[model samples]
Target: MPPRTEAHAEQQPAAVAVGKATPAAEVEPPGKVQVTVGGAEEAGSEGEDDDDDFDWGAAKHIFVLSNAGKPVFSLSGDEQRLSTLMSLIQGMLSLCADCDNGDEMESISAGSRRFVFLKRGNLVLVGVSSSLVETASGDEGGEGGEGTGKEEDEAAAAAAAPECESFMRLQLEYLYASILFLLTSKVQGIFLKSPGYDLRGLLGGADTSLRGIIELAEPSRGRGRMLAGGVETVWMDPAIRSRVARNLQAAQTASAPSGALYAVWLCGEKLVALAQPRAPSHHLSSRDLLLLVNYVATQPALRNAESWTPVCFPRFQKTGYLYAYIGFLEDPPSSTLPRPPPQGNADQNSPPAQHSDATAGTGSIADENEGRRGGSASADGGTQSNGSGSRSIERDSGTEAGGAAGDSCVILVSVESSSEQFQAFRRTRSALESRFRSALGTHWDRYLGSGAELEREGILTKFCTQMKALHFHYCLRGKQGGAPCVTQCLSSPFVDHELASNPAAQHRVWGYYTRAALRVRRGSCQEGRVFCRRRFEGNNGYFGGGGGDGRGSGSPAEEGNGASEEELATALFESDPVHSLAYEVGDEHTVVSLFGKRDGGAGGGGRWVSSSSAGTGRLGGGDELHVCFPSSVSPEDAYKAAVRLTAIVRRDRDWLFLTGTGAAK
Candidate 1:
């Protein structure tokens, strides 16, 4: 394989790439379908990671552009390179490897999410299927543009090939897994705040109202029909399932709102399955989920709702990444989505001639620091502090690429919450803001609004509403060094600790995070433990625990009291699974289903039974039961990984740090 690095792409100019068409034009066949940057491929170095640190070398930033050739999203160095490159290949294959039956466009990877936006400043990607993918005359046929119509000849002209789908899936897998993986160094978010360039508009009309943030998009056709809820997936490979599960669990702890909590958990190929009863008041319909996805699509910092409950939550044996982002720690307290001034009808115009100079291989990550003179973070839509928090300019810059005159765009991310239910939310937001300020130190924008003065001058929102109590907003500047995307911070445990330990306010806090395993234990109310009362808003119910668990003590005694025979029988069978060899063991008592839980009751030796049900008159079952998980991992390995992470966090005092040698190799 070739080395994976953005530096390699810099060799080619941003102008006309074979796969990236400037505008719709007539077809001129190349007569061949091939994968080529038409240059040498760069290989990435590898290292052993004993802890959080995996020696990533110097970083670079690369751009991800839409088919129109406008940038959609951007990432730092190596990681960015990998993301963009994969996108290109997959995008090309999407158009190239497709077969059609002459008349309409037929896509192998068809779904509702085929919408494409002409992104200007950020990294957003969409793959579209095309006929005559190799034709170059489409955009050059004078004004209206024309195509050879060679692609429309027949769907049979092409055959379904696995290469494109496989490649695209793998790339999605990487991003869905870790956007920082290919990085030779810690990835930064500096590109998010660059001025001049137009980032895609974050649409915010109403608060995202799933259990968390909802992702919504106004499809060109669907009046309101767009992807809602989480991306459905099938997880079959054991290794992949474990990895995705671990990461998803950790990222959940980082979200601030109702978030993407697992109301229903179905785990097992051979284990006993059952539904956990979630609170009756917390039922969320498919509509509820759709709303959440809609909301998320409009938020900032979060590029996508990656951890939102997946549409296909428990796909038994297929391996893939499923999930979405709902509420984020940093959300818009007010309804002000960030957008750029349109140069005209934005979607219009054949994108600029693919100037070879704009391609990742030839484009320098940063322009000659030339016009990088100082500017106010408050200029137009900028970052500013609230209350007595004097504007420190913390850091400021002017690296943002804008229109012909070369101006900068502004963005504000609200960190503090506006509610009393979460004073902790406010404090943590402030701390994160502070860390961001410090991280960008010399690179912060001088103009714009901070936590307090956003709406006064910048394109921003404040944290406040009937949902909560206070007001807070954060300014994001895409400067030379002010790492902009704070969401990536979830990878740091120490940072999480600092934010989690706010002394100002408190209520229920759990079920959210960005890294590490956060096993949400359904606490017993009778045990008097305070279970953070965040509500669930989906179909699934919660389940698990044996008969003697929480359920055994709560059944009613009325003559008309109802207990379905199926439910009662399940409960009875769980009490003595030893009597039946066909049962799988698991708990069913304290189950709190989110979407929909599993089969009836719990089974396996894992079930708990009271002496009354066991026929042994033991009347004894411990509240705290032990379950064994067989892993190839030794206790020592787990200990080592934990200790290593702790040490790195202590040394760096930052949530993100390097664990392996400082060298790339």
Candidate 2:
């Protein structure tokens, strides 16, 4: 990866120094490896007699060696001795195999021991294990069970050995991917060119992380990250999920000039939201995004501050690296603080190409760095303290958020190069934090809220208002196999005044519609979570306040009663599942439903459930507005509705969950 441009240097909040690595030649002899670095045994090394460490019940040792046959890592034992072993292994492989043309020497067996080799561009991984795999049948025979026939035993052995080898190969791939994630493909080359470079220094405090990954890779445990090859996404209420995703999408647009190719928010290692532009013919794959997340979580420099690093996402482009800017945004206070005016001098010197409309009147990235630097230099930095109590530039510039610092969240922005739009990234990060805090408010903690609370409350109505713009009516049911569901109907408030004025008279019409939605759910909600009914033929006479089926009729209850069974039965559509997109909209109970519509009407008709019923009303006909949405409404409008509804519903639920211990009101 190329070095940061001068503009980038000016905008960096703090620079981490990279010292020249000392030559490796002075410390060791060829074919002789010492495990100690700086005259002390490395912390994670296993001693020679560490036989008890074989609780894996197999040879769990692995070693890394330089091309010169110097030891870099070992599963156990002293370094000096391990270097000799590495050299011996290399010699044996070279003598027996023809690798001069660069084809790697893979696996070899000597009696009961087998050695496996996996080579990257300049590094090599070697695994030492027993050649024979003990299968279930083998164990049975050894345990004094009736001995199996010789043919069966041999077949089992053959099957088990290959599986073991495959498993070993997977471990090696994980090991290599993790290292690449840490040092990056760019820095790996730097290590090789220096020859004397000690990879341990580059590893820093990452040994524990790597060890944990290895332990997690054991077959007794879950699948390794390589096996999944994608991000482990967190499950969130669909309403919240849509809000978070849409916010990121908007931020990406605002930060475009900063060279942002994509933006993602991760709650630790689990992906919460990912945003990228729609125009680009290319986008990051889930697998590549997961790798990026792994690197951010494992690398101290990236996690600790607003740092930029050059990274090569092998899946995106193999020839070069991209610049990634990573930082953690601490949650805002309980009360929203009035934002300070945008500072002028902070970014007056930014490059012309990096300027953006989203940041037209705001401080530049340089200003952010200045604030951070000044705050840190002073003993009592006052407002400059980062929300987490660390000194921050935003505080210094009066752009710090309100309230005491809260939980910190990560924000990652990647641009193709430093020269792209450095200023835009800073602006986008600031805007995203502000928007997220505003939308989620005090309940913004990703881990907050339980599944049961969301279910009983029927909160999907609070955030599923966007479906109205799409002319979608949805029912979000409870978890019980056969229990009542809180169904929400929505249409734009901008409707025919006649329909809006007299909801009761339209009750029979709405009831018939409700039956359609219910029948769809009744038939299939048990088998699958979502169902959608579509009518492509123009109108089909279902819109004139009449029952489509011409049987049941429902009227608004006389005052205080729940929905009539007849009204409850009229679901949106009743057909074989056509198109369905379901999203978990709450921590537990609610899933936002996405239903499609095809209406050839004057105003693009829609409907919405009003907030009159807190989702528990008997005959819960809380003012349903069925209207024709303005034709100009687009997907962006739906996104905006989702954002607004998420904020309102989340705040409402926070209070509802806290107060409701009694029977439904």
Candidate 3:
């Protein structure tokens, strides 16, 4: 498969025609492909192909329409052609509008097709599905035979109706949320107010976002089995989440209006921290958050810098606008080691290019201190110390007057209208960011303990000491086809210290890490098969190759045509959320993120683990990090902390790719 692309435009809203569509097995005329509805398969003629199997029962089609019976959006089929069907649906819904039922419209079943409707003011969300399976009546025998009582069967059918209705309603809600994300409440209001407003034109760019929501809600998809409407959080210790929340809240307080709506910090695409007023009415819907995150993730321009955009939290107010100041934080790249001067003319007064501890094959963890004023690292007692000097904090200086973007957090602050209010908000945000930076610096100092040299002992000691602020960390590094190198904090539940101390046990653990990395890169999850479905199966090819590229059959290592350096780097460092995963594993919460290239494509991905660079072992090729914390932890903190580590990994590639006992040799 070819590597995935960056973004996809929203599909024009439309629905497939209701009918017995052609089956995959039957040979069709040129320019035609089989399209099925429900589970009824087309009887194929002799010599027809039948190898392709699709469960039509799992398919769902969604449509959005105005109360005027005009089509707004559709997830499948042709929109223009589905007007008649939509008119029929609208006509049916009109009859029920004057009934005793309140604003809501419950689902109605028409033969095999179930139509679920949700009325949101002037807009209507409709979900049509032929995949609803018949619920066995309570009176039915375990062997699929009828029970002796007719009343029991009737009661069972009644019992099953609610479940079916609930599922349909949920699907409708998903569609509505997706639309809100694309058009926002304010835009929707505008579209409604204007007579000639083309909702499709307003939703033109959101095709990918809409499709993602549909896939997430579809029962047949892997993510649907795992996540519902809630946001995907980076699992971290509660204490860390609290600290992050405090930071975000503090940031919000710096520039927030008296009625600020939401202040959130996103790491990659998952929400790691959020801050809001204590008012009871300040409830932020998880679905809204999810939708917003997905929207931002699809927007590549928002990744690198701070931007302010007019936004409407549809759940909060569907007809108004709020300005959101969005910015990102990233750990600055490590200062480059000065090149050695020519042997004869080297200046005797110049400071040595190398330190005593720095040697070939030995990776040095550089402190973030060198370039900034009053940033220093000490090696005594294994604790880092900041320089005793005053540092001026500055706000992000983007094209916009007041916003700033950096590597620490994805700051999203809401503000009221008016340039004066925006300027005030920017000042407030800058001051808050300064405070956050200072606090983060202090935290980094405590974690580093003296200097980067402390990491020389090994990956285990490095993780053990650096991650003392929270629970232990589990770090893994591996090549696409080779074994992985893994070391966890001594206190981790997954670690058996006695066995860990054993050389054989250590080798085994290393093997486990290697195998796990391979499995993840290959998208091999069976139970919570989220990545495999979204990436490998769907073949979005954002990082990996496209599925239609006709090369997905080979392993990632075998394909050797992964994303380019810039592409892989962007996937790792950019704000794309779909590339990351946050889900629960048993009682523990595990967040997984893939970095580097593993598309099995030949050249660009070769820079990852085990790939030779200047005849040295590669450190970060095909590397993926998984952090597991107690279920009590939230996913947000987990990601915030993980990204910091990733920043270090990005800088200290030499150390990570070490082949021998000591640094690169």
Best first by TM-score, ranked: 2, 3, 1
Q: Which parts of model 1 are misplaced by more than 4 Å?
A: 1-65, 74-91, 94-628, 632-665
Residue 256 displacement in candidate 1 (angstroms): 30
Per-residue accuracy of model 2 over 167-238 as CA lDDT, tens digit each:
454456556655655666664576568754567667667665555455434322223233223334443333
lDDT of 1: 0.21
Two-way lDDT contest, 2 vs 3, winner? 3
TM-score of 2: 0.45
Error of 2 at 43 (Å): 29
Could you give candidate 1's per-residue lDDT for residues 1-665 as a string of tens digits? Answer: 11112111222221122222122221211221222222322222222221122111211112344333334343333323343343443454334323232111111221111112212123333333222122233234442234535444322222211112211222222221122111111112334444223223421122222112211111111111211111211111122222222323322243355322321111110000011113322222222222323333333323221122222211110122223312222222221233333221212222332223212121111221223333212111223223232112122223221111101111111122233213222233333333333332233322111221121111101011110111111111011012111000111111123322542111011101000001212211111111121111111112122122222211111011111222221112112112100111112101111110112222211323332342222112211111111133343432232222222222221111111110000
- Residue-level lDDT of model 3, residues 1-665, one tens digit each, is 12211111111112112123232123242222222222222222211111122122433667777777787777775555566556656765664454342222344343334455667767778776552234462224242354437655543333222113334445556566567555565554664677345578777767767776666543222232112233433322233334445655655665534434677666444445566554423444444566667667666666554466666655455455667666555332221223222221212222323422213222334322222323322211111212121112233345232233432345454646655445554554554444444443433322222222122223334442343222232232232113211111111223334543554323223222222333433433221111112332333443444344322322232222221222221122111122223333222233333333432342122234332231112224433444434445465655555555444443443323321111000
Please report, as a residue range, the 10-residue window in candidate 2 with the lowest summed lDDT: 12-21
RMSD vs true structure, all candidates: 27.3, 25.0, 21.0
What's model 3's TM-score? 0.42
- Can you tell me which runs of candidate 3 are displaced by over 4 Å? 1-58, 94-105, 110-112, 132-163, 177-197, 218-229, 237-240, 256-261, 334-409, 420-665
